[model samples]
Target chain A: MKLSIIGVGLIGGSIALKLKEKKIVDFVCGIDNSQDNLNEALALNIIDEKADLEDGIKNSDVIIIAIPVDATRKILPKVLDLMSDSQTVMDVGSTKAGIVESVKNHARRSRFVAFHPMWGTENNGPKSAIAESFSGKAGVICNREESAQDAIKMVETIVESLDMHTIFMNAEAHDLHTAYISHISHITSYALANTVLEKEKEEDTIFQLASSGFSSTVRLAKSHPEMWVPIFKQNKENVLDVLNEHISQLKKFKSALEKENFEYLGELIENANKIRGILDK
Target chain B: MKLSIIGVGLIGGSIALKLKEKKIVDFVCGIDNSQDNLNEALALNIIDEKADLEDGIKNSDVIIIAIPVDATRKILPKVLDLMSDSQTVMDVGSTKAGIVESVKNHARRSRFVAFHPMWGTENNGPKSAIAESFSGKAGVICNREESAQDAIKMVETIVESLDMHTIFMNAEAHDLHTAYISHISHITSYALANTVLEKEKEEDTIFQLASSGFSSTVRLAKSHPEMWVPIFKQNKENVLDVLNEHISQLKKFKSALEKENFEYLGELIENANKIRGILDK
Candidate 1:
């Protein structure tokens, strides 16, 4: 099989490497607008060749869109228009509702499968790609019923070959749950980084006194803004909903602390501890 | 030198192990309110023997109080009252201002050193202790002027021997900085955990789509309430001030998302990205 991957950054580069390593793709070609990214991906053996999107779509059996969420919405329909019934196209963007809706009425809608692999790091770019990036993580497949059976089966086979568990959900449900579980985390981290950076003027003291818990909580603040800004925009409503609730929760905690209500603070923390049960599952 | 560690739980037990492993102390004894914790500490070889507070204070050359903040405030005065000029006493608690103020005018204040080691995990109790736990972390020695010169020297040597850098700060400065850097992180995490748990009812969905970012942001929510409650209460004013700023930051992000002001959101994230400089330092 031959594959064409768009973006050619962290997720795209990692997918290309994993496909070649597993012998699932005989040749993998990449399409990226950035010359530096294309050159780096080629130097790292992330792709067999680089080609334009038109040539990539015409030649490969599969085309994977791994760009930002807004870019995915713009380019997915174009790819769907160019795709044949025998070819498959999939997107690995974080938000699914917009892209899925934009392509729903297209002639070749059945050829597209929307997927989100629930794995990433604070780092980005082709150099950040790892060969075993997706192992042991869950890959969400949104609106599978709209896609062709063969396309769904092939996507499942590819994801499973990379050692990922697949879960199915509608685009609306996927966006809502992802806003709660994933997007809010990024917002909280960014706010936390900003809060600490605002007050702790002495950078040396922050570096010296930072504990593992602080590091862990603020790790996502290092994520690329180009990629995340589009995600926050595409899923604006759900993200805003969760963000409002999150702020309210923080206000309650502040009030409790101001009142010196240790018992209430303890109860809140204990209730939050129930997250262990959900995560441990 | 013989050492006695009060409150034979996570922090105290870990310190005992490191002292024993480095052969800095000829014998290690433990004193805990809970007999089970004492037995567990002994079983794990965190200490060689168990003793009451008075016995431990009188017989040992050095006494380490590693307990919750409230307990530390109540116990430090008693320990100082029983101390001799040849013996050094130190308390390892998260909040420094309250503990320091509680013993400020005590006659034996010169024999006591107030220290806060900036290292810990979400897990607690004796079983959570790890060997060489405080290595490479920063140890904050608060109000050094209140401590005898010899006591300060001895405590500094012990912290340095554990491969840690010692930073000197007054109690007020220490509490303010810790509230901004450490305490606020925990509050945000706990509130975030509760927010997500309240909104996302499908536990299976949360388990499936949750990313490393979510797990890291919520990790501090798993911390024991008993360990954190007193810390919050002790540093209530500083924690509330930082918490208010944090909530205001989140509200700004929420409004930006609500208004679809991508430019403002982008700038907010870009500004937050400046944290990389501090973290990398």
Candidate 2:
């Protein structure tokens, strides 16, 4: 199958590479507004060719929107307008609700599949793409009933070929669960990084004394603002809910520490260790 | 040189393995309160032999205390009392201020070097020890002036042999830096894990939609409470201070989302990305 992936950055480039590695796509074309990104993607062989939106959508059997959520909302409908009944379109954005809402009543809505591959790293751009980025990860196909069966099956087959498990959820449930499990993680990491940067004046000391725990906890702080800002905006209510709870939890930790309540702190950590069961699954 | 490491668990067992791999110590002995840990260390060939603490101290030229901070504080005096001028003693615990204060005026204080290697995973015990655990990591040598120059040199040589860098800091400075960089990371992770567990009811969704970002952010929540509780108690003030700032930062993120201030949220993330510079250093 021929595929045209927009954005042509990390997730887009990675999908292109994986599809070609699995021999699932005959040709993978890409479109990016940034000339540098387009050049980098082509130079890295992440895309077989580059084309304009009109030509790309008209020619490819599949069109994948892999840009930031804000851009996805703006560009998704345009692609849907040109899509044929035989062509399938899917989005790999982190947030699903806003994008789905925008295209819900479109004439070609049946051709559009809303998806979120539950995988990413802090880095971005074409160079950040890796061969095993999505292997062993889960892919969420939101509001599957909204898409035609053929479009759903094609997207599922592609995700399955990448060795990823596929799960179906409505847009609301997907956004809520993501805010709890995924979006809050980035917020915590960013705030944790800012806290350290604020309190720890000696940058040299941080570089010298940083342990693996610190690195792991602050890893997501390196994520791109352009990518995450739209996500927080799109899933505002759920993200706000989790962020409030996270702050409350930190305040309790602070109070416990101030009171020297080692027993309480220990209990909190023990309870937190229950995440191991879910993670180990 | 003959070396004996007390507590033959993750940190101690891994040190033994690396020392043996590098052929730096002629004979390595291990002593642990848990028979299972000692047996695992022996089966893994992480040590050349196993012995009681008294026997190990009496026979070895160098001794390493690699237990929990509370255990280290309790056992350090006994180790110091048994040490001769020719023997060197060191510790690999997370907190340094309390341990340093405990042995401040000891007669053999000059013979003891307080060190903490900035490396570890969420797993613990002998079974969790890996051969390459400390390679390319930093080893903090706290209050080196309290240690005899020869002893400090010997410890530094061992750290260097393991392909790790040695950094110097006073005990108080070590505790404060660790609270900011290491201890706080664990607490934030534990609190984040707890927050998700409390808010999200769909356990299966969490397991399926969890991304690498979530895994990295929550990784330290899996750390053993037995290992971390004392560290938090020992560095109570610094941890509490950083924890307060962290909570405030999260609150700022929440308010930005609640107010639909995308500009502020974007700036917050962009500022947080400054951590990438320190991390890359």
Candidate 3:
């Protein structure tokens, strides 16, 4: 099978490399706006051929849209317009509602699958891609019924080849759940980083006294704004809902401390400990 | 030298194991309110012998107090009361101001050192003790001027034996800095966990969609409240100060999202990205 990975960045390059490693896809055409990224992907052997959008879309049997959500919304219609009925198109965007709605009325809508592989790191670009990045993670396919059976099968095959389990859900539900599980975490990390940066004037002290816990909590602050901004923009209402809940949750902690209510503080922490059951680690 | 580790759980057991491994202390007497912990420590070779608090303090030349901050504040003066002029006592509490102030006017105040090893995990108990847990981490000694020269030297030597670099600062400043870098991170983590648990009622969905980013941010929520509540109580004012700053920072993100101010959101994230330069990873 031949695959075309648009954007040729972290997630795109990772999926391409994993499919090639599994010998499920023989050729990968890299399509990216940045020539430097294309060269880096090609030099790193993340793709077999670097092609322009037209060539990349026409030559491959499967096309994956792996870019910022805003960019994906703008280009999905164009990507669908250029694809033949036999070719399959899938997205790896963090937000699914806007992308699915963008091409809902297109003639080739049946060829596009709204898919999101639930895996990423603070790093980016082709250099950060790993063949094992998606292994054991969830591959969420939203609005699966909207796509043709052949397109769904193709995307599922790619997800399986990458060693991820499949999860089917509606586009709206996916956005809502992701806002809670994924998007709010990023906001907390960024705000936490900004908090330390705002309160702690001594950079050397922060660098020296930073424990493993501090680093782990703030690690997601290093994620790219270009990618995350679009996600917050597209999922604005849901993200705002969770953000409000998160702030109110923080206020409870503040109130506990101000009141010196040790009993209430302990209860709050014990309740948060309930997450241990939900998270594997 | 003979050593005593009061409250032989995670931090205390870890110190005993490492000192024994490095041959810095020949004997370790474990003291704890829980007999089961002492037995587990002895079974794991984390301690050589189990002793009551009186015997543990009187027999050893050095005493290391590692317990909840509230417990440490209550027991530190008594431990110092049992020690001779040649003996030294040090604490491994997260907050320094309260612990140091607890015994400020004691006759043997100079023999007690305020020390904190900047390393920990969500897990606890003797089973969680590792000899190398403090390696490459900071060992902070607050109010060095208040500690006797010999006591300071002994704690510094133990820090070196544990393969950690020593940092010296005043007690008040240490509490302030830790509130920004460490205490606030825990609050943010617990709050983030509670937000998700409160909002996302579907546990299975969270388990499936929890990304590496989400897990990293909320990992500290698994920390034992027995340990954290006291730290927050001791450093309540500083923690509250930073927590307020953190809430305002988060409100900025919320406002930006609500108003669709992508530029401000981008700036917030870019500012947060500065932390990448501070953290080694």
Candidate 4:
């Protein structure tokens, strides 16, 4: 099988490397807006060749879109229009509702599958790609019923070859679930980094005194704005709802501290500890 | 030298285990209000024997207080009252200002050293103790001038033996700095965990969709409330100030998303990304 990957950055490059390692694809062609990334992907051997989107889709049996959500919304319909009837197309963006809605009425809608691989690092670019990055992580297929059975099966086979657990959900539920679990974490981290950077003017002290906990909490702050801004924009309502809840929770802590209510504070912490049962398992 | 640990929990037990592993002290004694903790410490060989507070202080050349910050405030002066002229008393509490001020007027003030080791995990109890916990973390000795030269030197030697870097600061500075870097992270995490818990009703979905990023951001929510409540209470003013700043930062993101200010949101994320330079170093 031949695979064509668009926007060959961290997620795209990683999938390419893993599929090549597993021998699931005999050839992988790259389509990227940045020539430097294409050059890096080639030098790093992530793809067999760099081709135009039209040529890449025509030549490949499957096409995977791995760009930012806003770009995927803009590019998904165009790829579907250029695809042959038998070729399968999938996207691995963070948010799904907007992209899925954008192509809901395309003539070749049956050939498209919306997917999100639930794995990433703070680092980005082709250089950060690893062959085992997606293994053991969830891969969600949204609106799977809308796609052709053959297209859905092909994407499932790809997900399995990458060693990811597969789950199926509609686009709306997928967007909401990710907003609660994934998107809010980035917002919390970014705000935390800004809070420390704003209040602690002494950069040297923060560097010296930061513990493993602080480092881990703030690690997601390093994620690229170019990639995340589109996500927050596309998933604005869901992100906003969760953000309001998060702020309300912070205010409760502030009120308890102001009133010297250590007992109440302890109760809040104990309640939060319940997450251990869900996350640590 | 002889060593006595007042509370045989995670911090105390870890210190005891490390000290005993290095043979830095001739004998180590354990003192705790809970008999089960004492028994566990003995079974784990974290202490040479279990003793009453009076006997532990009298028999040991150095007594270490490793309890919650509020308890440290109540127990610090009493421990100083029982100390001999040549003996040293120290604490490993998270907050320093309140603990230091509590014993400022004691007759044995010079015998007491206010220390805060900048290391921890979500786990607790004697069984959670490990020998290498404090290595390479900062150990801050607050109000070093108040302690006798010999007492400060003794604690410094122990710190060095544990392979930790030592920094000296006043109690007020220590409390404020910790509120900004360490304390706020825990509050953010607990609030984040609760926010998700309240909003996402589907536990199975949350369990499946939680990425490594989400897990890392919320890991501190698992910390024991018995350990953190006192720190938040003792450093209430500083914690409030940082909490207000953190809330303000979150509000900015919300307003940006509400107004469709993608440019402003991008700018905020870019600013937050600056933390990578400090934390990754």
Best by lDDT: 3
lDDT per residue as tens, model 1, A105-200: 998999999999998888888999998999999999999999999999999988987789999989999999999999999999999998998888
Ranking by TM-score: 3, 2, 1, 4
Better of 3 and 4 by lDDT: 3
Query: Which TM-score value belongs to model 4?
Result: 0.97
Report the interface RMSD that candidate 2 achieves against the true structure, in angstroms. 0.9
Residue A80 in model 3: shift from native, Å? 1.2
In CAPRI terms, model 2 is classed as high
What DockQ does each candidate score versus the true complex, computed on alpha carbons?
0.84, 0.86, 0.85, 0.85
Q: What is the interface RMSD of each candidate, in Å?
A: 0.8, 0.9, 1.1, 0.6
Chain B TM-score by candidate, in order shown: 0.98, 0.98, 0.98, 0.98
Off by over 4 Å in 3: none
Question: lDDT at B258 for candidate 4?
Answer: 97
Comparing 2 and 3 on DockQ, the stronger one: 2
Instruction: Give a tens-digit lDDT track for model 1, residues B102-185.
Output: 998999899999998989998888899987889889999999988999999999988986678899999999999999889999
Q: Estimate each model's TM-score.
A: 0.98, 0.98, 0.98, 0.97
Retained true contacts (fraction), each candidate? 0.84, 0.92, 0.95, 0.86
Q: How high is the CA lDDT of each candidate model?
A: 0.90, 0.90, 0.94, 0.93
> Distance (Å) between predicted and true CA of B20, model 4?
2.8
Candidate 3 residue-wise lDDT, A1-281, digit = tens: 99999999999999999999999999999999999999999999999898999999999999998999999999999999998999999999999999999998999999999999999999899999999999999999999889999999998999999999999999999999999999999999999999999999899999999999999999999999999999999999999999999999999999999998999999999999999988964
TM-score of the A chain in model 1: 0.98
Model 3, position B130: C-alpha lDDT score: 94
